[model samples]
Target: MGRLHSLRPAMTSTDLIVPDPVFRRVPAAFGLRWWMAGWRSFMQAPLPWLGLAVALLVLLWLLAELPMGGLLSQWLSLPLLAFGVIFAALLRKRAEQARAMTPQGMPVEPQNEGTLSSTTQRWTGRIGPLLLVSLLVLALGGVIGAVIVMGLGAMFGLGLASFGAFAKVMTPGVGMAAGLGALAGSLMTLLLLVLLALYLFSVAFWFVNTLVALGGVSPWNAVKLSVRAGFTNLAPITLFTVLLLPISIVAMLPFGLGLLVLFPVLSGASFASYHDVFGDEAAA
Candidate 1:
């Protein structure tokens, strides 16, 4: 429930890389912990997540109440929201888990399998706080993201309209020339804007991961760190973005059922990446 952090600086070139202990080790780059993190996160506090998801889906369903709204309208949003929530939760959890895995002065062991009563207590104990924290952050973030996407959509529509107006008054001989020129110009501008926004968002995403990993920070500070880290590690982070973009698109092919698996793996990898980069302070 608390933010985790490292008192020491990141590992330097002279720092040694030691093998991870068996329980701490991740296999195949991403592992079960990542997947489990997502699954467990949902299991830990499903009602609130489900409520948020259902509310979002219902909003979408109402908006789509027109003729075009079909089974896909009523149901598709539910799954999509679920998929996105699970993915985000996994990322958050992996970041936490990665922090816990850090070899701090206090060595920590994985929680052992126990009876249902004790396990239930362990799970529910943090569920309340975790749900409160995750819901607040996610709600605010979701609203901001939705606003950006909607604003972009409006801008694109306006640009198209402006081009139509320009085409309406052009000379016949010059019309073709001007229309093509306008279309090309508008398209290029839109593309540039989208790319720039995406770059900034990715950076912000990384900062959030960092803050979540490093305990005790507020959401605003997390955003600041993510922005800084994104700028500092632009190269590899961009490389990661390029590599993952296609995979993310492909995962969306099956109407997002593939996300059940893909979400967890990527979530785990994000956590693993954090672990690899900054030694987790939560391990203790």
Candidate 2:
């Protein structure tokens, strides 16, 4: 197994503001390639990768069993989960760099690896900002959802009132207006919910975690760049989603235990996708 090591320079206290990142237009099939790369990375150090995934799952499960723990878990898990995956990717990257630097066919000695204390400190430093960004994103989603609900309610009210007026002319007290209004309201509510979900998902598709963890971008800037990059390469993003759907389902089976393997693969895939989109020049 490869030893864990700090692949990049230590993060600074000063926040870094990266420029708008450029993205490459990859073929739709690259989605599969990303998954393959992730799987390979996981295989290289299965024990550590799987151990991390299992630990996360156990923590989440325990949290979920407590009263109100589900809510607490939801909020806390985002950064913790992100930290593990991104950290693993960082270690994998460092290993790759070390290999590349070695002379051709020369024996590479075991070197100093990143300690747990350093990893925890680095991740803890970033988690606060990442959590804040997540909260802001949630707030945005709530606002969008509220607006859609209100607009739909207003439309339903107006439509019903107009229909009632017309019906009164034909026959007073038929009383079908209320029923029709309720039905329309329900349908509109469902539609609005769907729209809100799609909007939030679009926001997440951008590589925000990678921007923050690897690129050293401030949270807000990472969000902006991620969203921009996602939209700029919408086709590839769509293809990746479509390709991932079935794989995700399969990973959820086996009593959800498959995640031990799948999670690291996903982490690796995320790193690959980020690298593909923003090449070496984009690193902050």
Candidate 3:
């Protein structure tokens, strides 16, 4: 514990701006480090963490219930998630500090630093950066979505044209074969586009908000650094994403009750990965 605590850099004060955050490279297996750190963070204060997760889930659900709520929720999700990530970062720091303070003979105790209300109030000052990051994420995603839609639409049109040509061939068997081929081509095209969209959006959006909220990075700087960091750490991020698939499914299995635990775990994992890649130099 002492060894781990020692490696952490001193926490930056919230009031100071960190315009340029230093990035570090981590190993491919660092995905496991993220999950383990996340899990340990959850174990440290399971109850409060779970409670906060539940409250977050409930708040989102309620937001989604309002008129035009689906769109509103989508817009707000990133900003809100940044808020949660900030709180998780705080919890992580507090725990590490507590560990550092305990003597060799004493057990490290769980430190519950603040109520959710207090934490929320404390970080409201950073809402501008959080919301700015959120807006940029949505805008980039929107443009990507628009481009992909146009491309897919054109691809579908081509498939339909080929299918129509196949139908006019006058020979039943030939037409059927051609039609099937066209359909297959369309499906493959759709699959490829879907994957491309996911990859592009992931690179654009993954760590932008975290950089802004915790690192005090300006919005534009955060966006660039976030993408650079993504490419720089691609192997680790891919491994981390692959690991998420099964766990995410399992978390969804039980009326989503597992999300109370899983959400915070993922949050911790985000903060952990940030700490590893960006170091522990956070703005508060």
Candidate 4:
């Protein structure tokens, strides 16, 4: 009883101190390692991981069946799915910690029968904050997207207006050249805006879910920290994004069924990447 009591404080104390995230400069190949690590973690408890993934898929499918379901799924299902995967990763991480503490020859203690129920309760309790953070991120992304669209619209309008003014005074060949130049400029502007939006959306909330799940950090603080960490490690992050693009497309190709495996693997990879970049101070 005394030994058990002594261990309890150590477990609880880890959760109390929220350390500032640390960014690391990893090799481009580290992205592949992160994906592999995710696969190993999923294999550690495949059934439970798959069950969670399937539940999320079902929930998303049901949401998609509703009116304007595509948007609804984005707004509602994304946060819920994120919460579930992060929570599962947290549980797996905790289990890993517990096993590490067990003696080499001795068997680890069995998990309590109430563990699943308790975890579910805890997940439900914390979901409000997760959902709030998700919505806030979405709102921020929307604002940035709108600003980009409006700016592009203004640029395109200006280009067209200038082309119109010049066309009246110019020969037919000169007018054609001016119109093509304007068209090319407008297309470039649109592409640049699209890339900018993707970059902002990716970095803004990359680590928010993990921080919230594992560190118990507030949503706002998590966002601030995530953005800072993301920018600090932009090269590695860009590599990761580039590498993940094809895997993501492949995951969607199989009637979206590949997501059953790829989704959890991606979640695991995110968790692994978070650990690598930020260091697991809370787990330490």
- Please report the TM-score between candidate 4 and the true structure: 0.78
As a whole number from 0 to 100, the lDDT of residue 253 in candidate 2 is 89
lDDT of 4 by residue, 127-210 (tens): 666777777777887888898889878987888888888888889998889888877877897798789778867876777876
Question: Residue 69 of candidate 3: its Cα lDDT?
Answer: 88
What value does the lDDT take at residue 192 in candidate 2? 72
lDDT tens readout by residue for model 3, 1-284: 12223221223464554358788778999988889988887887788887778777888899999998887788788777766676677676677677778988898885675635555764575677777777787788788789888988998998898788769975888888878877997899799879867976785556787787677677778889898988888878888888998999999899989888888788788878888888754433
lDDT digits (tens) for residues 144-215 of candidate 1: 768877987898788778877877898776876887787788779878877887676655555343233222
Highest lDDT against the true fold, candidate: 3
* Model 2: per-residue Cα lDDT over 129-224, one tens digit each: 768766655666578768877877787677667776766675444546554666677678768767656854664545877776666666788778
225: Cα error in model 4, Å: 1.1
Alpha-carbon runs more than 4 Å astray in model 3: 1-17, 115-118, 167-170, 282-284
Candidate 2 clashing pairs, residues 3+ apart or interchain: none
Worst 10 residues of 2 by lDDT: 1-10
Q: Given candidate 3, what's the lDDT at residue 227?
A: 89
- Candidate 3's TM-score reads 0.87
Write down the lDDT that model 1 would get: 0.48
Best model number under TM-score: 3
| Alpha carbon lDDT of each predicted model | 0.48, 0.68, 0.76, 0.68
C-alpha TM-scores of all predictions = 0.47, 0.73, 0.87, 0.78
When sorted by TM-score, best at the front, the candidate numbers are: 3, 4, 2, 1
